[model samples]
Target: MDPVTGSVAPRKILIACIGNIFFGDDGFGVEVARQLMIRRYPSHVQVVDFGIRGMDLAYTLLEDFDELVLVDTVSWGRPPGTLYLIEPDLELIAQAGERGVFLDAHSLDPVKILSFARSLGAAPIHTSLVGCEPESLGSEEDEISVGLSPTVQAMIPAAIAMLDKLVAELSFAKKVEVTSKGAT
Candidate 1:
């Protein structure tokens, strides 16, 4: 509830986890999403495992959400299982294609997806991504059943912890305050 107004202030935040489980460590997002499913959260926060479902996620992004927290694999050339919070510049992403992005059902490209969302005239919203460095992304031609590496698997708790903090900040954080003293 608003402290001053004594009215409820609900901020819609979407925690959309995207990944392909068949591609080894690429499944990190899906796993984190699964673990978060059982936990409780404010009604305003929605957690979804958008594994390999780019179209579903794209359409969902059209909804009016105050913010979006995306969970996915990040290959940053660092050690596997490294977590990082990324606040991407939406403008740069929205410049993807003049013709607009067309998402493949099996493909999961958060950048393109966001671009597509913007292309569809979706309003801009606060967006953040909780990412983990992937150790191995198995190929569909070979051993695609390897699943998440042990290193990445152990970091699920850490990811969840990060998400919790992020959600709290996004859901309940106050606006930045600025004041000026004149004629003092």
Candidate 2:
């Protein structure tokens, strides 16, 4: 079921954490998401950690969901811990474009992941990226970015704020749809 179209059973939202945690700031997305899961959200929201697994996202396409929010660490000229909602930037893709190069130490390349998701027809109503600056990408084995810069820690609140905004928007939309259907 395509979440963007709202024609699926069991309204659901997906929050995907796509990053390599051991790599300094690169793991920001996954870490933030972990923190979010500690709270209780509505049953409709599905939070998943897609750490360095690009191909695994393919399976996610099979699920019927109403929205998808992707969280990842990306360099957007902000200080470490700074978060940004990244739209598909052609220039950035072009700058980082190299055949199969993982965006960071992580296994999945960010651009490729988006492209793959599109090819599979997995479109969501609103897809947003929350990113943070990295102080250091830790060793390969640990893959946990260490000593998240002060800026990076500060961005967590803003990131959570964005999630809250999305939740309200999605919930409102669902309510309106139900009301319209009842009227019909």
Candidate 3:
């Protein structure tokens, strides 16, 4: 409860948007953050465009959050613009760390970041990934492209809808947990 407001403070939720806007469809996460910013969210929800700053994201993870949602483009051999709600396995992330898989300073790898955060004894209680399949990563000329491909661009609405649903579910779960604790 907040002393000044005399109201219960909401559980903190961090929506980390990971992507490189210059790499065509790799900008999916950034765009999602942009769109979400214009909309209203619960007081405890923070939507940040982390871009490709892996180190910054790693440090930010130390600030505990009830939930962390990562938005990015994932290539799973699916059709372009396909959206996926993934629950990353923490054990698998730890295993990857043991295998010597590491994170690049300029690249945002959600799994790697989670593993690193765990190493530092700081990880969100719940972590989820909201990914979109990309048509292209702008590898043609090795130069940056400023926008998403048509296929990927078309799925922004779907991605936002999915995010809204996830946030609502998490918020409700948090409320239920608080109520149960009080009852106990």
TM-score per candidate, chains pooled: 0.87, 0.68, 0.85
lDDT of 3 by residue, 1-184 (tens): 6789897666688999999998899999999999999999988899999999987887888996877889999999999999999977666776766776577876887878777776776743477899999999997757878999999999999999999999988874643221111211
Model 3, C-alpha of 60: deviation from truth (Å): 1.0
The lDDT of each candidate is: 0.83, 0.63, 0.83
What is the total number of backbone clashes in candidate 2?
14
Residue 143 displacement in candidate 3 (angstroms):
2.3
TM-score of 2: 0.68
What TM-score would candidate 3 get against the native? 0.85
TM-score ranking from best candidate downward: 1, 3, 2
lDDT for residue 141 in candidate 1, whole number 0-100: 57
Ranking 2 against 3 by lDDT, winner:
3
Write model 2 residue lDDT over 1-184, tens digit each, in one string.
Answer: 5679877444577788877655666767777778888888888887888888877775585566655677877765656666676544533433433343343334876566654554565542344566666655665654454545566766777888888777666654642221111211
- Where's the lowest-lDDT run of ten residues in candidate 2? 175-184
Cα error, candidate 2, residue 72 (Å)? 1.3
